[model samples]
Target chain A: MELFHLVLRNLLARPVRSFLTLLGVVIATTSMVLFLSFGEGLRRSLAQELSRVGPAIQIVPEGMEGLGFSGYPEITPEEYRRAVAAGKDLGVKRITPTLFLVRGGFDPQTSFFFQGLPEGVAPDLLYPGIKPQAGRLLPSEEGAIVGAKVAKRSQLALGNPLRLSPRVELRVEGILEESGGLADNLIFVPLKPLQEVLGTENYTALLVALNPGQKAEEVARALEARLPGLKAQTTGDVMRFAERALRISDLVRFGISLVALVVGGLLVANTVMMSVYERTREFGVMRALGAKRGFIFRLVVLEALLLASFGGLLGLALGSAVSQAINLYTLGQVGLALSAVTFRLSLFALLVALGLGLSAGLLPAYHASRIPVVEALGRV
Target chain B: MMGAVRAENLGKRYRQGEKEVVALEGFTFAFPQGSTAVVGPSGSGKTTLLNLLAGFDLPTEGGVYLGEVALHRLSEDERAEVRLRHMGFVFQQWNLIPTLTAWENVAFPLFLAGLPPRARKERALDLLEKVGVLERAHHLPSRLSGGEQQRVALARALALDPPILFADEPTGNLDAESREQVASLLFHAGQERILVLVTHDLELAARAERILYLKGGRLVRQEVPGPSR
Candidate 1:
């Protein structure tokens, strides 16, 4: 017990050095936690948005890749109507086809994904209801449901007529709630007018709702077999892609955190080595008083453990605080919030930090124990 | 009476660079237990002789027996165990752990012995009171004056009540007054335990049971103090 106290006192002798080393570990750990959290939050947000629509499959025409960015696809009216007809024949409950505009279809404008729902259907029936800041949406052929972002950016109001390219005009019927999703920038329109403006009689992509007892996979296979030169996708495909992307993103984040942890471990090792070197005479004194080599080994290792454990705890607290603050800010601004931004104690990260600290103590402890007792006492 | 320390043709040599330097060669001595001092100027092998008897350094040739144990034959670890379990040492620097309090320093041997905390602390306090440093028990070695540190060291040497205590110039760094105080404490402890002291101070040597004078790594003279009985 006295020896332990002596070891602690020796470490605490140079207050500034010990504190600075601990602070270094804290900062490094905090950065690692924050970096991983940001990646997790983004991935989660993407997944949430994709899962909102009730398992609808979207089919975009080939060579119309930019339509996803700014709803403009080069599909002839015949092909669009054919795809919709094929979707209807596959026992689908509904086939809603629409046009999408990109970059708000004008210069210095944001892009929106505009899906045209069938007339007389409740707008909320097919998609999640929009929390309107100003007006309600009418379920009519001429009525339009505008994304909250588009309303805010274009400064359009309810009952206002907004003109699109090729002489298509839309009446704003309702505004949506801020969902922090792809829909935030989207503007819905009537299918006929949108197709007329693009000089097409067909939809750019078909949104298929399968009949009851019909799985999405079965319906997708049916639609693909029926339509030539057209592809069918289910919600599961999009989900799988999203999952793969998230896994890759997580791997990258994990790699970065690992590098930082290794660097922190090296810093700990260097600090312990320097401390042992500086306290050679002190170790000698203990050894001359009949302290065994194992005693010196444990003392130095314990000192390292003390320093690193202190740093680990401080880092965890700081990182958790920063992550929670970010989560709060995100919830306030984006409506969707992250539950945890840092590695929760539920994870194994805290244990990993302790293991790293112990590993760093190995070489320095060995060196301390091997110092000759005779040489130490000679100085005495 | 049996000698507290007996060396038989003890020889110690070290490889310095390319040549073997004999620190002590073919030396033999035995003195009655109590307070015996070995006095010599620097390089007279005073410390070398002490190291051999304390079972710290191995003799290159020949042997030393401390309390019937052939110390030179023990392994390094065994020697260290013997030191912890049976011997106590004091040094010129007073060699107190700078961070520990006076009482804690006195308790160090018991800690090495793995004694229970309560027993160790009790023994430490008792030894501190015997050394007349109980008031300074909680003060660190750095906080104490040189004389106080040496007194604490004396208490530490008596912590385990070892039969033999070896000190190399216990008061070498103290002023005259502090030196007297430290030497008196050490000599007082010798009444019950054998105290083998190595020093260059002839005045301090005169108070011992017998004094052995060394020159050029060899014992050149022997003197019995107190009018030679």
Candidate 2:
């Protein structure tokens, strides 16, 4: 502990060098934190969105996974009939076929996610416990219900006119309560009118709901076998696929961070090596005054660690602040916080910084300890 | 042999590039307790001899015995331990740690000896007061003038109260008044211990009870001052 105190004093003596070294570590750590937070946030959002879904399985075009908006709706009316037939004896509660469409970006006024269910199918079939914060769910073919975030962002209220195109017009009959889930970002429209807007009569996907004791896995397997042209994914299956994709993204992010981390290591090494070089004589003086080689070695190593620890802490703070700022923008645009700095990530980054310190400090510490006492004292 | 240093035919050789340069050769003497000075001109091996005697460098030939320990046979770590526990050093440049305050610098050796913080501070403060730099106890070495830094270095060297104190041109960089003050402190502190000083200043050498005069790398004359002050 006493030796450590001396190390702190030694670093304090050269504040400029220490601060510059610290900035290197901070930049690396902050970049890493910001990069990985996206994975953390996506994982959290996906989990919440899945939990809010009332159906146990989603059958979409082979490439379209879950409710994600992608590719044109290609499930023919015949395939939809086969999906319903596959679940006939499987104790299926409801197999609601819906159409999904999305358009626009950057401009909230022009952007929209439109979920089209058969007229009078009730939004509760897809989103359980979804309460109308104002008015009521779409009660007829000429009205729509807006998700809470969409209503707030686009400044829509019940009785406001919504024009999907010049030919398809509707009134906002309801505004959803914020569910803190995917339901908070969708706009529910009647299926027939949406088909008219798209000029296509094909459905998007089938959301399969099973009875309390029914097995979703067995039903999904049966549907895939009967309707082989389409893919049936259980809630777990969708999550796993999403998670796998996320892991790949995570590896890419970590790979990018490695470069910054290496630079950080070099910065720390350069600062510490320079310190060791400058203090060679001082070390010799200490050696002559009864300090052991280990003493000098430990002093150098401790200085590096102290520098890294301070930088790592500040980096975590900076990363977290920047993450919230990113989240603020995303929450406004997508109604989802797309970056989260988690506790585990914080711990991991700090440990990595310390590891960097140890690695960077070792060679210099060895050199410092090996200098003969006489040479050091003689160095003036 | 307590509080005594025995040099057994001490010699040191260095390879300067391709040529072997002999810095010291065949000089053997048992320095008894109390003060002694080694006086020589430039390139006369005073510093090399001091280095070997203090175990800062190993002798190429022969050995140095501080009390009963064969310093030449000890490993580097063991020699360092010996220095920490039983040796003190003062140099021309003072060599006080620039980062530490005057009293902290003095307390450092005590700290290496595993002294507790409170005890280290107390002992350091007492020594600083004795050296007349108590008021500058908390001032860093850079903050102090050259004379003050040297005084603090003196206090540090005396911190362990070891039997052996090595001084190499302790007053070489000081003004006359500072030199006198440092020399006075050196002699006063060396009265009961074995003090070995290397210097070119004949006046400082004459102050020691005994002086060895060196020419080149060999001692040609040993003189005893008529009376010790």
Candidate 3:
């Protein structure tokens, strides 16, 4: 108890030095938390977006994978029928074929990737839980369903005519609620009207929903084997590709976080070492008062641990506030807000702070414990 | 029980670069209850003898005993325990921790001994009152004068009610009036404990029951104050 009192007094004795050290830890911890949280949020948002595309296998034209944004290459009607037949033979539950038509929006300079689905085949099966927020579902071939962002940006109201081109005019039947991803940015139209506008009798991709007990990968493989010119990709395979695309940014964020932690550890070590140097005579006095070497060691370590814990908590609040601000700023532009901080992530950050404190204090505490009593006394 | 310290054929050596320096050698003495003074010049190893007696340092060639226990033969932790239970020290610099208030400094030893907080505080206040510094108990060492700091240090040394006490130049940094008051307190405090003081002041040395003179790290003679001076 006396030792603890002395430790507190010592820390309070040099308030400026202690505060500076704490500030260093706070900055480093804040950076680490922010970068790591951003990385986690980005990864989770991508995963959620991929998952929302449904538990179906996307069968695209084989060479379309390398095409950047020219839109999915059209597969012939004959080939689409053959793929659907093969999927049905493999116990598929449903198959939704979608045509991609890239056309200018109301503003001729801005283009929208318009998707066309058959009138009876529900787009809800491809994007589950997506319902019209302001109007009924598509009721006619000329009717269109627009995503929330598209509607907001275009200011299109229900029953309003949206002209994609001179020959393709459709009435806005519904506006979707925010689906939290790219789905909130698309415009859906009836397949036959879009096909008529594009003068095509084919779709760009087929979404195959397998039976409950069927494996997606196995069905994908079977479709690829039976349909020679089509590429069948399970959702997991798509997610893996997305993850690979995100790897560089994740690695960079991780490296920055690692540097921040190292800097925090170094700051702790330097502060402790300086404190030990300043209190040599005081420690000797404690030694003469019958304090063991271990007592001195524990005192130093306890001081560092206290500083780290306080700094970590403050950093967490600061980092979370900054992340929330970023989330608010990006939600409107990107249609996906940053992920919220979890309790587990907070606990992990605190644990990292504690581990850094212990590691940084080890050498300083050992040095404090090893000071020769007589020599330390002679300092005064 | 009152404890006694005895040093037998004690010697201490220091290595300065390649040269070996013998600081103290061939010292032999036994101290029972009451006061004794060790007088020597700056390089005469007076502090070395005190350190060995207090078990703060081990002798290079001999051993010290506290009652029936061989102090030098024990490990560092055991020596620390002995110091806590049986010995108290006052150094030339009034080595109170600068961060602690005088009261906390006085209560340090009791805290080390695992005494309850109420008991430690009461005992510390009592000792501070005895040393005439109870009113300064809340002041830090920096706030206290040199004499008051030394008095608080004295109270701290006696905190655990140790059987033996050692003071090294306790009045070296004080004015004449503070010195006289501190010296009076020291002599009165030594009435029931074995007190060994290391100092260069002959007048202070003469007040002790026995005075040992050292030269060239060796004890030259022992004397008792007398009219013959």
Candidate 4:
């Protein structure tokens, strides 16, 4: 206890030196924490966006290319049945058959035709639910769902009826929940109706769900073997390709975060070095008084920890406030966007901050510990 | 029997370029359990001898026995342990730690020895009272006068209640009256320890149990007093 007060008093005696050193440590730790937090957030966002795509296995027709966006595949009903039977043989579950088309607009005003989904196969049932803005989604064969933003722009409302052709009429059921994602521009209808409009009684693709712990690759290989000329792709494989694209975006964000952490380390190192110099005499005295080399090492490191912990606590509070402010501004005040950028201090960021603090002090503290006691005493 | 220091042919040397300057050459002495002074002119190796006795410097040859242990054979840490448990030092310059208050400085050795806070405070206060500098206990060394700082240094040297006290120059930096006061305090401070002082002041040395005058790093004169000078 007596020694504790003595060490504390020695540091406190030179408040300016101590405070400046502490400030440096804090800046470094804060930057490290913020960067790590950003990386974590980006990783989560990327994963979330990837999962937004439909199930792993998208069993398209033989030699059917450019299934996404081009919106057409020439698979017969017999081919779709064959693929479903092959997937069933491979023990795949929930094989949702979908009829895809790229015909002209369901409305004469738009050039884009709605994508078609199988009966009882809800687009909402895809990996990420296609949430509806207002009314419930389409029931079996009665109504149609439109992306909320598209519906709003098109001035369409629930219960409104639309005529795609002289022969087909469908009631607007619901506006899909805006996923600032790809689902935002989509239109969905019953698979049978869409297949009929495309002049076919067969689906262009089949989406399958696997049992937990079953490898998608194994299932897809089995399905491919069971049905010749049919291509079987898992949700993971599709998501992987999309994830690669997302990784590029994430890498840029992560790079910025990495730079921030390095800046933080430099800040801490500079401050702690200055602190060690200022406490030279005090350290010398401790060494002279029979304090072992390790004691001085611990003391200097403790100083760094103290400074970093203070900064980390402050940064956490500040980060939380910043996140809350963003939430308020984007969600409430401005109300111009679908979602606001939120700040989250994940456990990973907290641990990274702790690591930064510890490492930042290590070299400087070691140097402080090794300073010759005699030279320090003479100088003082 | 209870002598504070016992030495047998203690020697120390330093090398400057190719010249080996002998600081102390096989000097044999004992400081009995009472006050004693070493009076010698400047560059007489008074400080070096004090350093050797205080366990701050190692002997190149021969040995210094503080109480029962041979200090020359001990490791640096072992030497520090010996100093903490059995010895106290009052440097000629009164090298007080600048950051600590007078009382904190006085209690430094006790803290080093891991004494509890309350006990350290009580003992430091008690010693300050004996040294008559209790009122200046809270003042830092820089705030205290030279005499006061020396007195506090003296009080600190005695805090562990060591059996031996080593003062390189107890009154070398003080004014006449303050020197006399510090000298008197150094001699009469209530303790059953031996006090060894290095001084160039002959009158001050005359007050010790014995005065050894050093010339050319050798003790050339040994003066025994019949009464206090």
Candidate 5:
């Protein structure tokens, strides 16, 4: 018989203990995979959305310069004018002044991300490839174009009136075709109505698109130098900042997952140690029958590795299944696939499991190999 | 030095709470190449002598030699290697690995000796057949009767054709009829090899060409049992 078969038979001799140990590893791996997948998913989604944005640079209030800037618009009309005038001298495209407002609750029906641009600015000029799925873009200041996800969630169609306040209401002129990007969750309207609603004379940011042959980096540098109080951020700058933030969060997530890995490792150690202790007498018999100490050590350690391997594979399968289910739910809720199980993560989980097996097995295997033959044989 | 087994001033001591107990002391013997039985009552160092001579335990003050290699001076790992290459053992408890089938138990020594699977199986089957347990080769140790397990163990000890064999109360767990059957096979396996038996049965000891009586951790007498088989 092969040595592998011998180790297998030993583990199979008592099925309950092995299964319980396996279950502990599975739970640990599942939780780890599930938690880390969020970081992977957020990175992927942000990259996709960042690539789709039309503007090359955004000049905003200094602190509010990255993706998903949601604070009240603090940049005044004067600051926006200064940024636009400075960009006009450069090889720049049209500078669009936009205001952003968030009015909502946790419920999808009540939640709204409102982007207010100047009257008659074509939606495609600001968000490329945007077109009406149900109706046309805003034809007048009295009308609005709702994004695909928002429209579907609110069950709105063309000509349905959306209320921003008790006094400000506009007819839904169109519903945008789904692009599965950030714009899919916004409601686009004319700037005048939203400013009147906010009761403030301020602009959120000045969106700067560059003409052909103008590098955004140089233009953004010029814009920042021209306007000292305000900050000009390029798309690449925003993406890098977001990625850094995600990386820090990733570290925190992995630190939490490590807790589970440690517990799983302890379970493996306990199970293998008990097996070594209970089977010492058999080990002595084996030694008497001419089996070497190295062979006995390998037997015990191999058992641990087998258990860990099975647990890691099963955990990966289950974690992937769960991530797919989560993506399905998040896709329906926000038009975003928010959980990912990348190939690298699967490899990492398996390596961690094998590492756990080796570390857990060493002490027990040593004890088993060191046991005196006489004392072991002396046991009944 | 070759083919000769000898002990020189062999002694062993154990610590029990603040006192020392002598398990075996001042043992000297040149075991012949055939069969020899060491017999004594309980707590008379029968098993202790077997342990020292088999190199399973170290003697405190003396040494044992298999040819030129000193068993007592060798490290535990080295002693284990020697046992694997040259010594075969049968314990009183019929210590067949409970997880292995009858044939697998018999094949274990061959497997340890690095024999290929087919060759190990062939030799193990031949030995099992010789011991009259061939039909039960696939049954696990727990599923077999006590007599059958001991027979498989005997088959295992002879698997590698070792030059030295140690049987520690091999028939201690068997009934009278099964004892006779195991004793017959064991003696047949002893021919031309150094076979050492530690037993309490004088009847079984009579089958050996020589017997040494042990008492109070010392060898008291040696006699020629006169071939009664």
Candidate 6:
């Protein structure tokens, strides 16, 4: 314990150098935690959003498996009718066609996804747990329902007119309660009116709800088999596709974390090496005062451990703050929740910092232990 | 009775590039309990002989004994153990650890010896009082003057109350007045222990019970200033 105090005092003796080294560790550890936790948050958000949409299969034009809600080859009216018929034959209870369009937001450059459902389909039947918070659901071809986030962002209220284009406008019939998923950010209108606005005669995809005790995969396979030009995919297949699309993001996160760790380790090594060099003579004096090599080794390594532990704590705080700021900034438009700083992640960060400290301290501590008493004493 | 230190034909050699430079060779001596000074000129291997006697260095071809323990035959750790248990040392430049306060520096050996914190603190303060630096106990070595630092070093060397003490030019860096005061304290402190002084100060050398003169790594003469202690 006394030796530990001595080591601490040694670090305090060179305040500037120690502070700079600590700052380096803080920067590296903060970046590591931020990148990894953001990636984890994004992954969890994706899974939650997918799970909330329920275990329904989707029928889209052929080769549109992973293109989620955007830029898909539209299904012709005849194709849509045949796909709905095939779904009914495969034990599907409900088949609703939806047209997806991207329209400019209140701001010209920014855009949001607009989903169009059939005028008679109940919103609760399509989006479970979602209900009208105000007014009513879309009641006519010229009416619209704004999601919670869209209403909050665009300040659209019930009975207000929303302009889809220069010549197309719809009155806001209802506002949705927060659903805690992608539906929160969407704008919903009747299918025929959205098709007219998009200048298309076909739907983007069909949402098929399976009958009781009928498996989604079995029904999807049957629908695809019967409708030769359409593709049917279960919820699990969609999730896998989403995960594959995120592989590049995973690689980028891994790369950032790796770089942060290496930089942190190297910074620790450089700091410890410089400290050892500066204290060569003092170490010799300890040797002459009867300190063994093991004693010297422990003293130096203890300094590094303290530095890493403190730096890691600072990094965790900084990283968590940065994550909260990101969450506030993105506001879920990117479908990312950046507030996933779990206890497990905090523990992992501490362990990594400790391991790096020990690894980086090894060479310098060994060199300090091996310093020759006479030669070191001779140094000025 | 066994002498405090015994050396049998102790020799030390160094390799300066390709040549083997002999620092000390064919040296033999037995030092009893009291103050003895080894006076020599530069390059006369005074520090080398002191290092060999204190178990800080191994003799190239011979051995030294601290009482019954053969110093040269032991491993480095064992030799350090011996130094910690039975010997104390003061160097030429008052080499106190710069990061430590005066009291903390004095307590270091006690810390290495695994003494409890309260006991280490008590002993260190007592030693500082003995050396007349108790008031400056909280000052770091950098804050203290050369003389004060040496006093702290002296107090630290005496912390364990070892049976043998070695001083290698302890007053070499002090002013004349401080040197007189330090030399007096050193001689008085040696009354109960085996204090060996390596120096070229004639006046300090004359105060010892015996003085050995050396040149070319050889002891040329031994003079008894007065009756042996």
| TM-score of each model, in listed order | 0.81, 0.92, 0.88, 0.74, 0.94, 0.87
Which CAPRI category fits model 1? acceptable
B117-225: candidate 2 lDDT, tens digit per residue: 9999999999999999999999988899989999999999999888888899999999999999999999999898889999999899889989998888898899899
lDDT for model 6, please: 0.83
Q: In order, what lDDT does every prediction score?
A: 0.74, 0.88, 0.82, 0.69, 0.87, 0.83
- Reference-based lDDT, residue B7, model 3: 88
Listed models, DockQ each: 0.46, 0.58, 0.55, 0.30, 0.67, 0.48
Per residue, candidate 6 scores C-alpha lDDT tens digits across B144-224 of 988888889889998888888899899999998778778877888898889999998877888998899889988888999
True contacts kept of each: 0.48, 0.72, 0.59, 0.26, 0.83, 0.56
Query: Which residue pairs collide, candidate 1?
Result: A70-A101, A70-A102, A71-A100, A71-A101, A71-A102, A103-A111, A131-A177
Candidate 5's iRMSD: 2.0
Query: Between 2 and 5, whose TM-score is larger?
Result: 5
Which 10-residue window of candidate 6 chain B scores lowest in summed lDDT?
B1-10
Once fitted onto the true fold, the runs of candidate 1 whose alpha carbons sit more than 4 angstroms away are A2-4, A56-123, A126-134, A137-139, A148-156, A160-166, A178-186, A190-240, A250-267, A332-339, A342-349, B1-10, B27-33, B62-78, B218-229
lDDT of 3 at A140: 73
Complex DockQ, candidate 4: 0.30
True contacts kept of 4: 0.26
Residue-wise lDDT of candidate 1 within A172-194, one digit each (tens)?
88887776765666677776766
Residue A243 miss distance in model 4 (angstroms): 9.3
lDDT of 5 by residue, B51-133 (tens): 98888888997889988989888888788878877888888899889899999999998898898999999999999999999
lDDT of 3 by residue, A226-295 (tens): 9998888877877677667667765687687878888888988998999999888888878777888888
iRMSD (1 decimal) for each model? 2.3, 2.2, 2.4, 3.8, 2.0, 2.4
Error of 3 at B97 (Å): 1.3
Ranking by DockQ: 5, 2, 3, 6, 1, 4
Stretches of candidate 6 exceeding 4 Å from the true structure:
A56-67, A73-95, A105-109, A155-171, A194-248, A257-265, A332-336, B1-3, B227-229
Clashes of each: 7, 1, 0, 6, 0, 0
lDDT of 1 at A144: 79
- CAPRI class of candidate 2: medium
